[model samples]
Target chain A: MNIRYPNGTAYHQSAKRPATTMSQTTNYGDRGMSLEAELNESNQYYLNQGVAVIHKKPTPVQIVKVDYPKRSAATIKEAYFRQPSTTDYNGVYQGYYLDFDAKETKNKTSFPLKNFHAHQIAHLRACVAAGGIGFAIIRFTDDVATFLLPASFLFHCWDDALQTDGRKSIRRSAIEAHGYQINPALNPLVPYLNAVDQLITATKK
Target chain B: MNIRYPNGTAYHQSAKRPATTMSQTTNYGDRGMSLEAELNESNQYYLNQGVAVIHKKPTPVQIVKVDYPKRSAATIKEAYFRQPSTTDYNGVYQGYYLDFDAKETKNKTSFPLKNFHAHQIAHLRACVAAGGIGFAIIRFTDDVATFLLPASFLFHCWDDALQTDGRKSIRRSAIEAHGYQINPALNPLVPYLNAVDQLITATKK
Candidate 1:
């Protein structure tokens, strides 16, 4: 089935998987769905439960050309995806401003630093500075595991990687130690806010 | 000159103005620019000064068809605008979750309730219930007056208008009485944060 984004961009589930990996029938907590989709579901649950008000910002598109037809809706003839200056998701939860992005990696042992863009990192950093909670929900496609990594820790890793001899990726062990692992659940799929509560508590300290 | 939104939607300044009114030669604090543009500039100013981290969410587009040509950028062939689920602007300021939309009107005596969508009001209500600050930056194009009306008051107006005998619009007199007027400034254009500071103070009480 063809899944199109809000911007009409095609999304292929198979393309998201590592090229070398063979298709496995076994599903891990709704493994077929992308991390973003899962998170959206989770946010909807939260909204319905009156737990939070969060939403994924629409995909940013730079429209270049458009044609207006008589008595019909305008048609976009040319457009391009623009690099987002902020994260994919943000909203208010318990008076705290929540800002974050969802990323998935197929690596078994570690997550690569290249998954994050410099501007995204900067935007997260600025949000943190302004007293908002910033984080990244990283999913390991291999095991269908997800982790909520705080922006403060992410900044540390991002800056460390800038060093000449610094490591290019974060070890899975390090993430396990520093980040909050999000267990998948039925209602919210990702069940990320349980981990977010832990982040909020830590920030207060 | 043609201006395209991030979603490639054309924005015509002339179309925004009331057709019955004659275009005045004198400018009222950059009259030609849309309220969205002015607020964007203000948000940028706030971000730069480390006063706040706010942004206008991109225009939502429902993409119907796209063509990917080999060795060339993908072209969006067809797309339509989607009704946004939330307000256009939201961010963190001094640890407060701020959500708002900017609206402008040509009516001199009153601001029409019709200018706001039901979803936008509901979204703002949800945000307020979650302990976030919610408001609207209403602009009167006649004198280029801007005001920040708290979402609480907006809810009252919205609900009132729903009644059989209620007024269809909010009078400028009432807006002047309830809403905090925003003076146009050179640096930020819409220095609405000063009004937001008042909101924060009131919420604390």
Candidate 2:
């Protein structure tokens, strides 16, 4: 199960200096406004309206060596991924705990299984068991449609990895059937907060 | 009132790394453990014992410089806190969504106001309003005791920063009155999950 970027875009290796967007760094990945930036803007919108509380998790970077070039802006010349994070955002929306991962895939038909790691799958499983609403926001770039797939379905697919003839992706039809479709909006950009509102209302009943 | 660390050690900028029991690097202002390590470990423990599910967030690091002295190990020489983080940890324990900050202070009598940033306070406010169990764990190193103070309490103390002769720290009495005290165990370093159990039991009853 290999999740391939549009044009063989590998995991981005950050540079010493903040250059351009990931697309400019490498066009192979079909990268755009980083998911981090979009979520941040969305969070700001949530804050302004007093609607919901949502935030993107910070990437865990293990700092190794630092260079004091001028006493300001410590240059992290060496670092490593501390640990693979479980999800992208986890907070309270309305009156429930909202935890999810937002990911974009260039594939038109299915989301590649390689996009998620085993640890992340385990995390979602535990979160769901503990009663938090765990889900994933999968963006099918080809159709430009995003769907909120509950983590339970994702975990079941992940568990299938143990099977002999296991598949490698979640097809579009499956998402259409099980996931809550999300459309982008002006103020919040991702407009996921609205979906959260809907889910909360539905779940309460 | 500001909450102090156990030792009454006031927060002072680190001229050089203090040889304390830290993960890698930390400062007088910033608590160590990268938030990721702590959460990952906490998550692992959650999975093993079926306690809770929680994870730390990912943030984009504006990497200024990097030196690949060797192929295997890329050293980050420069990096900056890109955006203000919302909180340290958020997950579901039992049937409640929990959001909190895990902070360590060396002060014995009171915890300082400077330890928390403006954004964190704002984020906690939103989480609390949304009905999540939002609070913070303050470690007083001198007494080796960690207290779980509610976000409501935090809002009052932090907002008191400008009261002109305002109480800049949360006294031990206040924490004892309003916070859930956590005692670290061998398995979980922070053992906050236990405190959550107490909170859940009380809420359920």
lDDT, candidate 2, A49-99, per-residue tens: 887777767667886666667857656666776666567677777667777
RMSD of each: 7.2, 9.7
How accurate locally is residue A14 in candidate 2, as Cα lDDT from 0 to 100?
A: 48
Which 10 consecutive residues of model 2 chain A have the lowest summed lDDT? A15-24
| TM-score for chain A in each prediction | 0.87, 0.75
Error of 1 at A15 (Å): 14
Worst 10 residues of 1 chain A by lDDT: A3-12
lDDT by residue (A136-205, candidate 1, tens digit) is: 9988887787899999889999999999998889898888988999998898788889999999898789
Give the runs in model 2 whose Cα sits over 4 Å from its true position. A1-37, A68-71, A197-205, B1-44, B56-60, B65-77, B197-205
TM-score of each: 0.88, 0.75
Q: Model 1 in CAPRI terms: which quality?
A: medium
The global C-alpha lDDT for each of the candidates, from Candidate 1 onward, is 0.86, 0.71
Report clash pairs, candidate 1: A63-B8
Q: What DockQ does model 2 achieve? A: 0.45
User: Candidate 1 residues B1-205, lDDT tens each?
Assistant: 5543232112235555454444435464655678888888989999999989999999898888899899998878888778899999999999899999999998889999999999999999899889899999998887778899999889999999999998889999999998999998888999999999987887779
